[model samples]
Target: MLALEELAAKYIQKTERVLTLLKSVNVSVSPDEKKVYAVVDEAKRYLEDAKYYYEKKKFETSLVSVAYCEGLLDSLRMLGYVEFTW
Candidate 1:
């Protein structure tokens, strides 16, 4: 059985992977509106929140954070920052 510490570490690693995937998206900067920039900001914030909740042992909240993280990724893809893979 995986220890709590190990499980936490794994969760954190998964969170980090999500962060990296978010960063890999390339967004174009437009003069009038900055869509990608906003999405990235939201994603970073959500990912941080996920980490916070995970550290606090709030699994449900962390899961919600992960949802937000995926939402942001979807938004990024919709905005053309990333190619649609799923």
Candidate 2:
């Protein structure tokens, strides 16, 4: 449980950092703007879910949520829908 908590904390921090960085930059999408915005919105929702689970002491679930959020952001970056680094 301690290890899971530690891992979850690390991921949460990473996701938060990434989100902060994202907010500081202007993201221009090559594809449909509405679709890209929707994906970004979904990722933000996952981040919120992660935080909620973390506060509830569900470290494993929090980790999963954060990972999904990170994956979605990475996908957007890799697909050239957003400009940012991890």
| Highest TM-score against the true fold, candidate | 2
Question: lDDT tens string, model 1, 1-86?
Answer: 97554555565567567667544556344333466667777877887887788788886777677667768777767766765443
Give the clashing residue pairs of candidate 1, or none. Answer: none
Pick the lDDT winner: 2
Collision count of model 2: 0
- Output the worst ten-in-a-row residue range by lDDT, candidate 1: 24-33
Clashes of each: 0, 0
User: Candidate 2, which segments miss by more than 4 Å at Cα?
Assistant: 23-29
What global local distance difference test value does model 1 have? 0.67
- What TM-score against the true fold does each predicted structure earn? 0.63, 0.85
